[model samples]
Target: MQYLPIFTKLDNKPVLVVGGGDVALRKCRAFLKARASVTLVAPEFCSELLEHASNNEVILTQAYFDESHLDGKMLVIAATDNESVNNTVFELANKRNVFVNVVDDQPKCTFIFPSIVDRDPITIAISSAGTAPVLARRLREKLETLIPQHIGPLATLVGSFRDNVKARFKHFADRRQFWEGVFDSSVVSKVQVGDTQGATAQLHGMLDAKAEPEGEVYVVGAGPGDPELLTLKALQLMQQADVVVYDYLVSDEIMDLVRRDADLICVGKRLGNHSVKQEDTNQLLVNLARQGKKVCRIKGGDPFIYGRGGEEVQVLAQHDVRYQIVPGITAAAGCSAYAGIPLTHRDHAQAIQFVTGHCKKDGQELDWPSLAKPNQTLAIYMGVLKSPHIQAQLIKYGRDASTPVAIIENGTRKEQRVVRTHLGDLAQQIEQHHIVSPALLIIGEVAALHEQLAWFGSSAQISSFAQPLTDVA
Candidate 1:
């Protein structure tokens, strides 16, 4: 937080660059990209800089750094290889109170360049306050892969409708809510998938629909980490979600799938740390929906399975608020499948059961005997820390000490890891792997099948297994 992050509109601003070498060329190019009228002050210019000046893109002054160059300049950049010259430029710019960046000299700089990811109207700036430029660039590259190329065009589409949206929703909050709804709708997705016509059609439908103040809530399941695993209904609700209240298990990759403009609130619950209380989260959704906003109560896995989706829905119902439940790929099922373990197998397990490892109160009793049935498959959610206790109970309740178990950490995510062991050694195995939360524990013979069924280990493998996107008539 050393530098205040901002997107300065440089259009029609005069920017001075003091240098003629490679460093100066880069600064000049950046200024041009920002739509700044650049003036390069140097005794000589490089081939690239000369060409830019010749093309009338930049005004080149073949002269040494001077205070006169600071006149009428909104911003200045000193990129000369000569340290003394760069220092002189910094002093002159500071005297004029103009923002200046001395390349590679953080102490002398009034501002610093950031690693930029440009999607035209959609620009992502990554900076480490001039401490780590290489790390910033690396992060920028990683982000480039996650963000789709069509985002720029999609941003432009949103920009085009800004005036219309403002005209329709006069209140500041109302306009914010309207744009959030538009982002979650098919309009943005269609544009992202290169269907501009479809996007326009959907947007027009929204605009023509009678304006109403009634809001609703969609308790959406974000699915186990992977965005593609989301259900059609879940995806639909996400597209129309005015605000998304998400949990900790939801990955950044999955969150990125959410409409860019939608207000995202992290109500994620972590072990021993409650950032947003359950009751408060429920009320937040209730309050927003009452304001006629489409609220997406996004959670990891199926909403009904330990997701507290039912409770949120109950609150909505009590207040007579309209709501829809969008089922997601629950962690137990998704982790099992991705790890090549089936929750149920005809020969090994005739029945499958899902149970929570922890209770609302400490030391609460659970049906240990029934859960330890030899022929049943058990998937325990939020049970890693209690694995030893769970194993002891099951072993005491007729289950064999050597019953197979598998731990899937960060299940269905890019960094997912799976460890297989017997019930007696499952706790030791978890500790050895340093398996963390947002994981699933499977106990029974079916857990042994993970080695045979594991497939989503690599991006290429996953891509090959994915079903092709088909056109619906």
Candidate 2:
């Protein structure tokens, strides 16, 4: 933000223009349009300046630039051809803390005029900080054509009933929802067709109608680690939500994009730490929506894939709560791509299994016989703590000990680290590197391609790993 944009009300305010030629006349016209009391101070006046003075549009003084001319003025503009006079006016204005502009001279000006699109009450100002005025003007021209003429009238019409609407709905959220409904309704169509009377009638009718408020839940996937991976619909729901219920897996960058005022509730759980229980989280979502509050239930990766999203949705459905499920890229796919390891490859493996090594309960085991089959890939999520058991079981089930394996820690993030080894050393590499949670284990021949095809996070990778084959062939 090189320059902060602001709209000033110069209605009847005193303004000084330190020039009487064509440039000064142009500056005076802009002030007059804003209903400012413009005074031009120049010894030699242009013909148009004389005409304006004769019509009392601008008061003209036959005098050179002086410090006294700035007294009692809200704004000043120095448009003279003399650089000395422009610099003098700039210094005097700054000394008095008054805003000033020098025509065609950005550095000397305290305030520069922006290219404007004026639709009366709706004015759009575009500025390039005086770096590229032509580009700014082109942007303004495009906006002027894209913005419909009916918007100003529509705003005025809605503004007229603002007080009445405020009195009708005491809560801000209720008022916002009501306005959103109005924009989606036929009232806007009537205004577009120039039927102001009909539009006003429809607005009044809507205000008179009484309806019970209902809430909706957005089960959004924040995606695997990267904020950019989140879907557009997920982002929209996050902004619109009155409350955000998130997990620890969601990145802080993604959390920053949520509505600033939205109430945040962290149900985030780690391997051994649980902030809020799952049952309590489900009940909380039900209770919030029952109060007519829009709730955003955000999780990492696809909600159905190891995210416990289906459980939350089931609770909402049991309570008759409305919800929309937004899917996200699961860790298996996101981590593999970021680590340069394909989950399944035609030459390496034809089958892929997404397995969870750390179960919710102990004494539970996966189908090791089928998992240890050849020409297959296994993406084991949350496998750090149970890596030794997993490795031992796979080898016991006839999976070769030399089968390639890769451990991706903090996948798809700036701090991502990929440790490549063999299936026999899966647990050894994890222990040696001190790999932590949120890491994915890619096992099978497809994992060997990580060293050859790996691209991202290479520079960020730790240097203590075993010798990495530099050449693929």
Clashes in predicted model 1 = 5
TM-scores of all models? 0.55, 0.59
lDDT: worst 10-residue window of model 2:
464-473
lDDT of 1 at 361: 72
lDDT of 1 at 373: 81
Q: lDDT per residue, candidate 2, 199-218, as tens digits?
A: 89878877886433456688
User: What are the runs in model 2 whose C-alpha is more than 4 Å off?
Assistant: 1-206, 457-473
- lDDT, candidate 1, equals 0.83
Model 2: how far residue 399 lies from native, Å: 1.1
lDDT for model 2 comes to 0.86
lDDT of 1 by residue, 44-109 (tens): 999999899889999999998889889999899998889899998888889889998998899888
Candidate 2 similarity to native, TM-score: 0.59
